[model samples]
Target chain A: MTVTASVSTVSSPECGAGRPDGEYILIPAFNEAGKIGEVIAGLSACGYTRVVVVDDGSRDDTAGRARRAGAVVLRHPINCGVGAATATGLAYLSNVGAVAAATFDADGQHDPRDLAAVFAPIYDDGADVVIGSRMLNPEGMPRVRRIAQRLASWSTFLLFGQWSTDSQSGLKAFSRRAIGTIQLKTNRYEVCSEIIAEIRRRKLVMREVPVRAIYTAYSLSKGQGFTVGLKTLARLFIDRILHW
Target chain B: MHPIQWIMLVFAAIAEIAVVAGFRRGKIAAKGIFFWTVLWLLVGLVAVWPDSTYIFARWAGITRGADLVLYLGFLAVFFLLFRHTLRMEKIERDLAALVRVLALRDAPEQTNQPRADGDK
Candidate 1:
């Protein structure tokens, strides 16, 4: 697990020392004020400090709650969608000098306790990007979500020849280089599918790590159901094929 | 000419006349050079009077004089649109630069962590 020091000189002393392992946590949220504080607290307790919580035009005080929870907050004036929020977070990471950034859910479905599970490969194991796969250990998975996940995963695999254990999981990590390439034009939920498709098309080194998924009634209701799933698939096709 | 076509022609002529007058007066952003360009474009659609000439022409065919005037009018409109597109491009560039800077400012500082993926 020895990383070459080729990039050390390019990084400033602050960047080199503060994040020698090249890691940061990026959380994009939309009106999750009720849940963001707890999520941030959990991550902070686990020593995950670099939390970038993007408030996607929440009428409520999602940003304020995240700030109070010690997570740095970014706000979108209007709801641009999850894709734009993630892009804003990544831009922030690159802007303020982070080596890499990971996207985690704000709905409390994902555990901040497992921060290293997704980040370790990119930081220590020399992988370009890593995905946190709940399907690898889908003990708490609901039937509806499982079906939706399977459809999304299959379509991506069929279209882009990119197959992973979990395609719809929001928990994922990205090296700086990977984020740079993800700067294409996507401003909504379709962007996650777009990222997977792009990652496969570029053949960037990616691996999936088995992780726990908490699917309480709250988190399950927060997810898109059948109709939205159909719409998401349609959008993914247009973006990956027609629009690519 | 139909009343609208007549009005458009009158407006276009006034605008074109204003441009000439401005050139003579040596005015750049004056009530002529730029504004006339805009006015010409706005009223340019009038020159395409597809039904106007048919209804108003002597032989139900486009008159040579009217046709020539309409051609020039459209040319003026297109030229203005091109100029405006260039201006819009400049504004878009500035906007993109500003957005990139604002998005990147105040990024969270990074440090080592125990990950949430539950990985070693």
Candidate 2:
């Protein structure tokens, strides 16, 4: 399917005044057609006027749905993985001169209300990166997920020499400097760890904010399973060796 | 010569002929042709004269010529596999970069414009 560049503007008079200037919400979605529209609508309800969704060559109508829901949709020609999608979103944001940007999941797991807390450190404290930590408010979070997150955090710390409370959090904010400074090479879930490593390498200030994770059956199913987690770790190790 | 030696010699001759054919078809460069030619010639010589392998094996401090050949063959396979892996990774990275460029170039002109539904 040929997806041409099209932007659908969502004009909400009531929420217009609350829109944050020069700040965009970047969502990397793959086959999230069932929930992508609602995710975009939720952002619209939250007074966020700038939303960019990178459809990572989904087999469904995710790109069309996102465009119709008032998001600037960037469609990959092939499935390049979530990391590639995020990098594409960031590159587009940088090209458009976004001052700050937040990466949010399209699976409807992340709350739009937490956007403020995620962007707070970037705008107020001059933080280069702000991570929305689910561990800070783990209420309703699955025990298995929590343990997996802890293991990932420890792995990130050991490999990158940078400790993050939630290393794999999808909800994170990046200032313009952070967006430009951090170079992402991984094309999968491993990009999360690569970002943390970039934070240490580039001397970027990072802060973690308390954010609630709304985990539904759908969201839980969409998350990385045990096998996927192992693959990600293996890829991370291979990447390290290859680049080293 | 032993039956195994005769088999080895025939295989080496076939490989040499294939290499020459590849070079004639312009699929192999001059340097590649030279390298493969030398390699196959060495293989044919060792197969015809089994004692030649022992002399090299003794120089390399390997007791058996067959053992030395086995070690060298394993090393060559590993080196080729490593090179292939690196090339594949480079291709992956390049493909991703191309995809990103295409996505960005095809992006809407006004990315930050407000939508009619109050979304950007």
- Quick one: best TM-score, which candidate? 2
Which parts of model 2 have CA positions greater than 4 angstroms off? A1-17, B16-46, B49-72, B114-120
What value does the lDDT take at residue A38 in candidate 2?
Answer: 95
Each candidate's interface RMSD (Å, one decimal) is: 6.2, 2.0
- Scanning candidate 1 chain B in windows of ten residues, the lowest lDDT window is B111-120
lDDT of 2 by residue, B42-115 (tens): 88898898788898899999999989888988997898898787778788878999999999889888555546
Which residue pairs come into collision in candidate 1?
A114-B115, A114-B116, A114-B117, A115-B115, A115-B116, A116-B114, A116-B115, A116-B116, A117-B119
Give lDDT: candidate 2, residue A156.
86
Model 1 chain A weakest 10-residue run by lDDT? A5-14
Error of 2 at A67 (Å): 0.8
- The candidate maximizing lDDT is 2
